[model samples]
Target: MSRQFAILGLGYFGSTVARELKRHQNQILGVDRDESRVDALSDMLDHAVIADLTDEKALAELSLETYDAVVIDVDGNLEASVICTLHVKELGAKEIWAKAHSDAHYKLLKRLGADRVIYPEYDAGIRVAESLNYHAMVDFIRLGERQFIVEVETTERLVDNCKSVAKLAIDRDSLFLVAIKRGEEVIQNPSNDTTLQAGDNLVLMGDLDALREIGKQI
Candidate 1:
C-alpha cells in the first residue's frame, strides 16, 4: 500500500527520502521554508508548501494528522528541529521521524515523541568502516546489538571453494546461510547439497563476530 508522508525540510537528506518515496509511488508532501527548495520538489510530491515548520499556526493549517508519517529534517538548527518535532506531535501526526545532529539531539527528539531518530553521518561512518575492514563484505544490515544480515562475495581464496554447503564446516549455531546469489539467479534457503561457485554472492545472517570470522576464514 502507498503511504502518505510529509517531509519538513528539503535539504539533502529530506530531499533524497522524498525522491525515493516518490519513485516507489508513495504520496509525499514536501515542505520547506526556502522557496527554491519547495519549487525544486513541487512537481515530484503530492503537495509542496513553503512555510516555517516551527510555526504552530502554519502547521495547523496543513492538516498534518492526515499524513501517515512526518519527517523533520532541519539539521544544524537544533532548536527549530525540536520545536518542529513537538509541533507535529501536538498536531497528532501518526508517526514522527527526525534527523539528529548529535547524541543530545537524539535524546531530545525521543523525549519530544519522535518515532525514529536518524543519525545519518554516524550511521554512514559505521558502514564505511565496516566495508573498509572487510573487503568481501558487500553490505550488511544490523538486526540487534551483535546480530546482522551480511552480504559476502565468494572468492577462490576461501577454504571451501566450489564445495557443497553441507561440508563447509561453518558453525551453524552462530551462522546461517540464508541465500545464494549467482549472477541473476537467487536461491533462497539453498539446500545443504547446493554448491557454492567462485564469485557467488552469499547472503548470511548471524552474530557479527561470527560473520567476521567467516569472512576471514572464507
Candidate 2:
C-alpha cells in the first residue's frame, strides 16, 4: 500500500521534500503560498494549491485527515510556519514533521504537536564537518555516548588487502562490524571472513573512540 504525504511551503526545502518524496512509493500533495509555485508544481505533484497557510479557515479546508505524513517547511516566515504547524496538528494529520531554523524554533514546533522537528541546514553542516574530518566515512550516526555506527565507503585496500575481520577486531579492537552498504545491496550481519571490495559501503558499529582509532588506521 502507498502512503500519503503533504509538504507545505514551496521554497527550496518544501519543493525538495516534494521531489524526493515522489522518488518513493507514496501519494504527495504540495502546498505553497506562492501562486507561481503552486501553478508550477500542479502538474508535477498529486495535488498543488496556493493558499496562505496562516489563515486558519483556509488551512481547515485542507484534507489533512487523508495524509499519513505532513511536512512543514515554511521558511522565511517564522510566524506562518508556527501557525501552519498548529493548523496541521489540529487537522489531525497522522505524523507531523516540521523543519526548524533554530533550537528555539525546534522546541516551539515540538510543543505545538510536531512529531519530529528537523534542522536540515544544521544537520547538513554537521555532515559536511564530519566528511571534511574523516575521508573514510560517508555518514555517521551517534548511537550512544561511546557507541556509533558509520557508513564508510569500502575500498579495494580494505576489502582485498585488509586482513580478516576477526584479526582486525583483535588487532584494531573494533567491537562490531554490523553490515555492509554495498551501493544498493545491504548485507546485514556480514561475515567476519567476508572480503571488503571497492564500491562497497561498510556499516560498522562500535565504541566511538575505538572506531575513531580504526578509522584513523583506514
Candidate 3:
C-alpha cells in the first residue's frame, strides 16, 4: 500500500529520503524554504513546495497531520530543525523522524516528540569502523545491547576443510546461522547437512561478541 510522507527539508539527506520513498511508490511531498532545492526534486516527488518550515503557520497550511509520516532534516540550522519538529508535533503529525547533528539535537528532538531521530553521519562512521575491524563482515545490524544480526562472507581458509554447515560447529546457545546467500539464491534455516561454498554470504544472528568471533574464523 502507498503511504503519504512529507519531507520538510530538501537538502541532501531529505532529498535522498524523498527519492527513495517515491521509488517505493509512496506519495511524497518535498518541501524546503529554498526554491532551488524544492525545484530540484519537483519531478521526482508527488508534490514539491517551497515553504518555510520554521513557521508553524506555514506547516499547518500543508496539512502535515494528514500525512502518514513527516521527516524533518533541517539540521544545517539547529534552531530551525528544533522548531520544525516542535511545530509538527504540535500539529499532531502521526509520526515524526528528525535528523540530528549532535547528541544535544537528538535529545531536543526526542523531547519535542519526534518518533525517531537519525544520526546519519554517526551511523555511517560506526558501520565503516565495524567493516574495517571485521574484515569478513559485510554488514550488520544492532538488535540491542550486545546483540546483532551480521552478514559475513565465507573465506577460503574457513571453507577449505569445512564443506558443510555441520563442520562449522556454531554454538547454538550464542550463535545461529540464519541463512546462506549464494549469488541470487538464499537458503533459509539451513540444516547442518547444507553444503558450504566459498564466497557465499552467511547471515547470522547472535551476541555481538559471538558474531565477531565467527567473523574472525571466516
For model 2, name the residue pairs that clash: 159-196
Question: Model 2 TM-score?
Answer: 0.88
lDDT of 3 by residue, 75-134 (tens): 479999998899999999999999999989889999988999999889999999988988
Q: Which residue pairs of candidate 3 clash?
A: none
Better of 2 and 3 by lDDT: 3
**lDDT for each of the candidates?**
0.90, 0.80, 0.90
Give me the runs in candidate 2 sitting further than 4 Å from their true place.
155-161, 170-174
Q: Model 1 over residues 1-218: C-alpha lDDT tens digits?
A: 89899999999999999999999999999999999999988989899999998899999988989999998899589999999999999999999999999989999999999999999888988988988898888889999999999998887866255487776657889999999999999999998889878878889999987887788756
lDDT of 2 by residue, 32-90 (tens): 88898888878779888788888877777878878889899897677888999998888
- Candidate numbers, best TM-score first, in rank order: 3, 1, 2
Error of 2 at 154 (Å): 3.7
**For every model shown, what is its TM-score relative to the native structure?**
0.93, 0.88, 0.96
Worst 10 residues of 2 by lDDT: 163-172
Winning candidate number (lDDT): 3
* Residue 157 displacement in candidate 1 (angstroms): 1.8
Total clashes in model 1, counting residue pairs 3 or more apart in sequence or in different chains: 0
What lDDT is obtained when candidate 2 is compared to the true structure? 0.80
